[model samples]
Target: MTHSSTAPTDLPVMLPATYRGPDALGYCRWLAAMPVWALPVMAGLVLIWPTLVHAQTVYSTEKIMGIMAKWLPLLITKGFSMNVVISFFTMLLGTIAGLLLGVGRVSDNRYIRGFSWLVVQLFRNSPWLVLLFIVMLTLPFEIRVAGTYFSVPDWMKAVFGLSLPIMANIAEIVRGAIQSVPSAQWEAAESLAFTRRQILWQIILPQCFKRMIPPWMNWYAIMTMATPLVSLLGVTELVTLSRQAMEAEGNNPSLLVPFYGFALIIFFAYCYPIARLTMRLEKKFAVKG
Candidate 1:
């Protein structure tokens, strides 16, 4: 018997199918719940494994300890004495400049806005290295402060050069962070008869700072790492010292690895804790929000 067969087209599938089975979902959730440190540790192990395999012999414990003792003190001193100091001051001045510039950027007055825009555009568009060179070499000699015989010092020149570009970037970050605060919060402050300054100081800036800390810390870390650039102007920071030490150990092929590696470890040691703290603060703030 012949029967006519018809294609069944009762219902169309709506949602795209994905292969997220229960076990897979559970595994993903478990991975997501793991501490952040696990990933970095795993990555480090993966990176170092090849190096370890290729090495002819592992470093002796005593040799490693000797290397650490010789290098660690210098690293600590240089990082704290110069890198940290420069970074802190740079961040502080940058924050202040950025705040003012950002406010000027949003000002209703066209002249103020245009001037700030020009400053931001010029600084932002310029290379930091070139600006650093100009400030250190050219600016003091060429442009004296009006009615003052005292010219800016090379150190101050370096600081200003490094800081201004950072300030321009930070200005945009500050502006965005400020704008991100709820409009309702601003309105509520106004309803309470608060002055602009009072509202900004009391209500807005606190929340903005909380949001800004991570990026601020990141910027500071970068600046701290860049302390070596100061050596170009004869500032003699850690990297300079490392270079000197490397030169002192002339013709020793193995010394370069330990010298530079030790210095790198120092930088990472200084930076990692701050980065972790920033992450914690960000997480806390996220939870609060």
Candidate 2:
């Protein structure tokens, strides 16, 4: 029977191999583990690859670099200063006001609490542009200091306007963080014959610092970004000067993307780290119920 079945011994047949080398198996595993969105991103890159290549070939990369080099210093020197000064003063005033309001919110007197709540609500709910315009239009442009004339700059008005909403938001953050401490903490402090003010200052606030830090940094980053709103008040901030620089570039519509992209990169470079730090802090000091 075996001899009869061996008639086709010389015929060719294909057999599948079951074994793969370590490298092949590893590559397959890595591909399987990749994020679901990776394929779409790769596909998008493939689609845009030709356009990028074409643009690079058609345009002089050196010319674009030259333009960026010319304007970047001016933007940094003139535009950056205005943003920094305004943001600094705004944060300073806002922090002071926010601390006061937060303390008032927790005061024994109902009037103090109501007044603080009113202020927070009034400022927080209003649009920043509206506040900026109101301050710019309504506030006196000049003040006499010790019989000397001093004119208030638009940037100063912008600072005051920006501070109002920040004050309100920070007040809420302060209030919430203070309130998050257990009632047992307050009771324990009271049992030890500690005054309410003493307890709040020495015990509660120290503990609240960890909780407050992340939100404070988050808001600071937001306020820094919002400094561009000062441009509306005629303060020459980063955005305003960016426009001026663009104008100097012969108003070339094609340059819009690059100029704006440069600004975006600058802002991202500054703000992204702060954002990442905030997230890291939030994770570190996350209060378990």
Candidate 3:
């Protein structure tokens, strides 16, 4: 008998073959170069596939669609409007408070500067939820404003809570923007015998406005997102309404993903445009500088 050795090429392969399709290099380059929309289309089809199969089996597609159709209008009109209203008041209150504190931060008096600094630090360091709870649960239900008695709404508490951190952030923005102005400009104003207030109002603050706007819009987007947190305080915002919709569907766990996904879409649709606008404004202001 003669001894025989197998060549490597003649041996049976034990390793799995590598995948070689459109994903492989030099294989269907056109597929690789397909438009990005194809990805979302494919992904969306895949995402809905499970739901489709389940609905076909369980006959719940029409039911889910019916629920969604009913809730959609409420979410858009009432829930979204509530979110916007709370956010607007929050921004208004925050901006006014922040402007005051920011100006106070740079004041000649040490007491005013210290007080503003303390206020900023206190609110900035506190957790937003803690502030929300404090405002919503701890504050008296009825408050006397301008000597008139009125009941404070839960949504108002949400705004008040949300504004605290916003105020601090805007204060910092204001302080930094004001301080960033060149000392030469201040000296020029002083040489003209202009009062500090006049110099600030006419020269410094005006310049700060452009700088402040970009950050202000950025913060507005953030605060708008945060508005959903008000739902935790029993305010009927988008997220809260979404929850109610899901529950109304007999607490169907399957509906959770769809409902929440719907809310996510709305938020993205709302915020993404604002974010893009903010970026554009920032670039425009930057180029002007």
Candidate 4:
């Protein structure tokens, strides 16, 4: 490449292709695209954090990281996996319930529509932590069905709690997606003597599917990050189990950064890609209304 000899060495680069190179947007994408473990590894380099040096033998950063490495499996299996499980189930349950609720919001019946709106507002406005606490406290520990008792697990309760908000948000997404379809489609379908149900299921809903997907993925990311809230309710998900592992390993001040920071790093690792893809889908499916 040819360049002016008088060119300043430190001017921001502009890539010849794709309009990228340490500019604001490119820099952000680059940062978010970093390896999953990159942030934690960076923290490890700062060895011997002054604030973490308590009144005891200061552990080397290498030893702190080694401790984290040794307990990595437990954190992933018992802790992180539960976060995944809770997020998955929450999204699943929420999607089903939300779809129904969304349909209800647009239902022809006044009562059904009113009830759906009320429910959506109530749950969507409620604090997530409060909902978790309410579900954890109010639900029976065990239930009887056909003279058989099955006990509810704490994590399951957390899933139920999280699902409520997800359901509300998704209900809104569904309603909006459905409404975004041009009214002319509905009118044209009706011109063909198609019933409301037929138009909705076959014509309207098919178009709404693409519009709904990006928001659905976005909500899943939000719900996954919120899974850590379960830790406060004594659920043994990633954050909760992370703390237990820290305690088992002596709860050194130095361990805090690596352990909790590791959790944050992995969560970002999981969510950032989804966020990027969501943006892409949103652009691809941009509804010209």
Q: What are the models' TM-scores?
A: 0.68, 0.76, 0.81, 0.81
lDDT per residue (tens digit) for residues 1-289 in model 4: 2433554454545333343332322322443466657756755643445235544547765677678789889888888889999999999999999998998898889999999999999998699999999999999999899999999988889999999999998899889878978999999999999998888889988888987887788778878988999899899888888888888988876777778877887787777787677766666765442
Order of candidates by lDDT, top first? 4, 3, 2, 1
Q: Is candidate 1 or candidate 4 better by lDDT?
A: 4
Pairs that clash in candidate 2: none
Deviation (Å) of 59 in candidate 1 = 15
Candidate 4 regions exceeding 4 Å error are: 1-57, 287-289
Tell me how many residue pairs clash in candidate 4.
1
Q: lDDT of all predictions, in order shown?
A: 0.67, 0.75, 0.78, 0.81
Kindly give the stretch of ten consecutive residues in candidate 1 with the minimal lDDT sum: 22-31
Q: In terms of TM-score, how similar is model 2 to the real structure?
A: 0.76
| Tens digits of lDDT, candidate 3, 82-129 | 988999999999999999999988988899999999999999768888
The C-alpha local distance difference test score for the whole of candidate 2 amounts to 0.75
Using lDDT as the measure, name the better of candidate 2 and candidate 3.
Answer: 3
